[model samples]
Target: MKTFKKATDPNILKHVNALDNGEITTVSLKHIFHHGSSKYPNLFRRLDVTEENLRTQELASGTSFAYDVMGVNGTGFKYEKDNAVEEFRNISMNELKSSKLDWRDIGKWLPAIKNWGTLINLAKMTYNAYIEMGQEDWYDLGEEYSTNNTFGWEEDGIRGYVFASSDNKTLIISIKGTSMGFGAGPTVPRDKENDNLLFSCCCAKVDRTWTPVCDCYKGGYSCDKTCLQDSVDGESLYYGITLNLVNSIYHEYPNSHIWLTGHSLGGALSSLMGLTYNLPVVAFESPGERKAASLLHLPHPPAIPWDKMNIYHFGHTADPIYMGSCNGFSSSCYIGGYAMETKCHAGIACTFDTVSKLKWSVNIKRHRIQEIIDNILKVWWNLFKLFPDCKNDDECEDCGLWEYIE
Candidate 1:
């Protein structure tokens, strides 16, 4: 049986220290994840991203504990039917790649700029990501203002969607979050007849065929760096889609301001894609993990080219799903794995201080995208309603959800 451990416990403190050690980076993760594997095998097992193991954990937990895993893999796998439609005129832009963000300058500006309009746009995208819609749904979203969405592609192992403003100026690409499905991210092992090719992690890739440090899902995470590289390499499911999207977009949109957004694991993908595209991104409740060795050129925290790209992460400080805060809370072990050590390195955080109002108690409700959106909308309304013109105009025309007429 699992029991709660104090945050100060030596076993947990080491990881906490390592995560916040300032020196840690994706480069450092190469050492830490493998070297520290022995120390947190149990933690890794709990994080196993496979259908079978997650199913076991869900049954043991007596609830749906692996929803995030499902979101990442289900749609990704379901859509990879080799059906390649040339819908996206620019396949490169449609298939953007994923990269890590510059976390160093994230807080350089102090309190985040509360541009309600940007928040509303991000919130709408978050809603689209959460509800799992296609292009037509976005077109018929019933909003007065103009917004357009296009279905990208689901070939190889990539399943994502794209959208843009009415003028087709500020282009926004959104990836769907982890899907809820019967078989989450699972890999069918390569048998003698299978030639080492297998499907896992929401995409198709060659099996690492190495012994994992901890117990595993169908497709496993192991210390064999070479095999690991191949697992998520060019032929890897998600990255292939991302690469194609980037190639298409880079060639077509020579000067468009590209933006990316997603929630959960989708948020992770958005961050990766933003880095790959070197553009602005807004992510909701993303788990932190290491970039593949091939992306070593990506900059580390405290030294990012802010002028080139900007990233906004809106995770409630109390949400373990965003970062790890479960060391003291036994119930949150699955958050970013058992030790809850997964670390996110996105740009400046537009965080909500949920723990403060709750008297320092943690609640998962703060992690909900809709909940965050509701709060953002409220802040906008309160500020807009304070205007003398807005409040005094008793005969003002209804502006839909806006507090004042445009």
Candidate 2:
């Protein structure tokens, strides 16, 4: 700890000071190296880290995109698997093991990167989250996560579920997106009675409903800005409810860590909530959440490091929702006539493509969380074999245990 020094850049130093004073959360620390580099270029140059070293640093440092998670010749995204059973089966427990060298090493998590089972399970949980929202009745879930887990579940009216097992030290918060089956209009009614927990959206007549308020989230197509506040972690009423739910669960299970998963709108919410709490987050086929990140005044890329607050953002080439298939509003719709930047995608992204056979898939079908899962299942072979195998423990040891299997 003594080896680390205060950053020289004032802007970054401010956040670091806030972090020390507990004014801001740890999530604010992600991608914080620019401060050091900007103010200490000479010192940085003297340190002499090579590109190879830099690439290696990123896998565990959370500085690069998902594609860079595993170096061109390392673990993480560079890892791969085959079929559901085999994908989870042959993986060595060694891959999930953690080491001191890894920066944001979550010592005992099985779903870090290459763990297909965890990814699939979370994807399934995303489905359960949807089912929790779409089903007219609470108990109508099918092949979904059980509400009967050890500590049972907490339903947010129709917003999401907090799955907890009394014996386990980690809890999962699964969120549901825009499609509410029981609602009258396609749009989510921001009624006071509902606590404004849902995004104001409608699955039908989407174009006419006029969504997409931001760019990258581009063009400022705000879903619901009124429910939000003016400071860090000050999310809309929806996430406020989620934050409380998570806090209550955390209070009861004081020793547990939190994991978040969701699809579409839920995914976006998870990103926001995860950032708010500095928890590990994995979202499927979700849009870039600029507004949410705005509250934190998120720094440039790598705002939340994969090693610290791990976020795995999975998207496919065919998903138009996140990839801007529909595009955002015109410049006029944004605040101050300035189009909002939609590229506020946090963490390491795990973006890939599954062939979309349908003509409309470029915009719709492919964006489905199920479709992304289906593609992963369909192509279950290890993806990162392009790199050389680890000859020994020293060559491959890192806190994050992901195999770069080809």
Evaluated with lDDT, which candidate comes out highest? 2
lDDT of each: 0.37, 0.40
lDDT value for model 1: 0.37
Model 2 lDDT tens row, 158-178: 245454432334456676664
Candidate 1 global TM-score: 0.48
Instruction: Tell me each candidate's TM-score.
Output: 0.48, 0.48
Let me know the TM-score candidate 2 reaches against the reference structure.
0.48
Model 1 ranges with Cα > 4 A deviation? 1-113, 130-158, 180-222, 289-297, 301-308, 326-340, 358-365, 376-406
When summed lDDT is taken over every stretch of 10 residues in candidate 1, the lowest stretch is: 27-36
Candidate 2 lDDT at 283 equals 85
